[model samples]
Target: MIDWLNSTALTAFGVATTWAEVLGFGTGLLNVGLLVRQHILNWPLGILNVLLLMVVFGAAGLYADMGLQVVYVILGCYGWWAWLHGGADRASLAVRATTGAEWLALAAAGVLLTGGLWLFLDRLTGSTVPLADALTTALSLLATYGQTRKLLENWWLRIAADVIYIPLYGYKGLWLTAILYVAFLTLCVLGLRAWRRAVLA
Candidate 1:
């Protein structure tokens, strides 16, 4: 399965798109689409999506992104359980706005993690776009953590990360993954609107 996933799925626009990238693209779309609807299934599908993307990013030498996927898998697991039980009296989760303190903490953590990952990737790995990779990776973790908590601001963080990710994936020749991020950006917008309505209700 690993070998097959690493093999070429198709040649599009002269780029040999891997099976991992193609499947990752599909799962990523489904994951976010479900997320927009506040569905629990998004967690499992998101886990699958990141697992596939780990292979794709590994091949592309985006080591930071590759490592990010591993963390995403752990976050995905926590998100799955949280959505099912992390509410008042251990009920289902509900959408809510982030607290000001939470926002400040997330911002501080994002900066610190980005700087730390940037240095590690730049000095310890062969990552060519270490800063951008680290930035997006940090933003993605913040977004995913917010999502797990049913925070509306998660969509904003996702929008920020996807904007950087689209170009980064494209530069790495992962055309399908780049396109996936474009779709992700659109989903993030929809998610923001939907979650806002949920909070207002």
Candidate 2:
């Protein structure tokens, strides 16, 4: 029974990780836009994808990415609760554009966090491309936080991160994951368009 379970899990993990990444990237594109548009249902779907990707990144030995997944789990929980009760009178959160000041702050924070993480991981873990990896990881965290708050700028951050991640994952031989990011890049464009319409409406 245990062996069967293991076999099942392994097979499911293999197929689901790659396929789910493809599907999940699409969902995530919509999810992030929905988030920025203050749609309540986005949180649940986002959480589901995050949980799945945690296992996938772990198996791939992308430790920074694996750690980022753990962060996503927490962000998912926070996003869920926030979307439900974050607005006035405990209503759903509202869609909001980012202020210029907020954009500056986010950029500064991303740079500092990424730089620090790169230094730590490079020294302790001997990570290849630690700077690039940490930059993506840090920006992603910022984006997730922005998403939970229904901030419009999260899509921009996602677009920037996906640009870097395409080659990074491909270089690492995570071809499927790289492709997923490519798809994610396309989705980001669609998401931007969708959210713009939502905000204008």
Candidate 3:
């Protein structure tokens, strides 16, 4: 099963695209599309996407990103529950802007997480892109957390991470994943606009 997943699905533009990356890409598209529509099914698809990409990133020696997938699984589950019952009196979550305090907290967390993960990856792992990996991982965590809570700023965080991830994945030779991030960046922008409209409505 693992072998099949890692096997090349296709070669395009001189890059061999793996089945895992293909499936992850499909699921990622669905996940973000659903999220943009405020649909509840995005979480399960996102979990599957992360699981597939965990294999892809691990193969690319992107240790921090591989580990980020593991964290994403946990956050995905929490997000699933949060979307269902994380609102006032356990209602479905509604989109909202982040509070000033939440912004401060997320900023502090991003800095600390990026620094710690960078140190660990740089000193303890064979990762070549430790700083970029750690930075994206930290931003992704904050974005996923904010997303779970239906915070509007999550899209901005994701946009930032996706921009960085494009070049990082390309440099790692994961061209398919890099392209997926490009699409994700677009989706994040759409998500941001849609959620802002939701907030206003």
Candidate 4:
């Protein structure tokens, strides 16, 4: 029993960095809705998550994702301030869905960004998973922006990305990260339901 416990601890230590990232990602999704609803506590939690994700993605050689975390850090701060002060007479921010035109623009931008990154990284770096990396990176950017704007469709984008991310991370031997994405899939579902209810109610 002692030996089993030791093994478990060792394995956990090996994945400690990824575990932090998982916790952060989970909190981030929850924070997104909370922020959309103008809750004051979302920023700190989001900052914590983005900080951890920066470390994890950097270690994994996901440069774009690492950069995305940096953006998240900035956006998280901006969002915190905006939620608190950018409203009429400094009131809480309200939830607002993205328009169809904006969604199309975002989608087009995602495709262009993904394609551009794929081209550059495929030629400049010797990454084994360039295409998958590019796709996930681009989609994450879109989802993050959508989240910032309180778009109801962000959950759907996250859901689609996680479906691909799970297999990709698993293939790269990032089992813990893959598990996180799997959990993210579940959270996306919950987020969708929760937000839909909020929209209806």
- Per-candidate TM equals 0.99, 0.80, 0.99, 0.80
lDDT of 4 at 155: 84
For model 2, give the 10-residue run with minimal summed lDDT. 2-11
lDDT of 2 at 109: 95
User: What's the lDDT of the predicted structure labeled candidate 3?
Assistant: 0.94
- If both were scored by lDDT, which would come out higher, candidate 1 or candidate 4? 1
Candidate models: Cα lDDT each: 0.94, 0.73, 0.94, 0.72
Q: Which digits, one per residue and each the tens of the lDDT, describe model 1 over residues 81-170?
A: 999999999999999999999999999999999999999999999889999999999999999999999999999999999999988888
lDDT of 2 by residue, 39-121 (tens): 67777778776765655555555668778878888888898898789888999777678989988999899889998888877
Q: Compared with the true structure, what per-residue lDDT tens digits does model 3 show for residues 48-67? A: 99999999998889998899
Stretches of candidate 4 exceeding 4 Å from the true structure: 1-9, 12-39, 87-90
Clashes of 4: 0
lDDT of 4 by residue, 144-167 (tens): 777666667888888888999999
Cα lDDT for residue 12, candidate 3: 56
RMSD of each: 0.7, 4.1, 0.7, 5.3
Q: What 10-residue stretch in candidate 4 is worst by lDDT?
A: 1-10
The TM-score measured for candidate 2 stands at 0.80
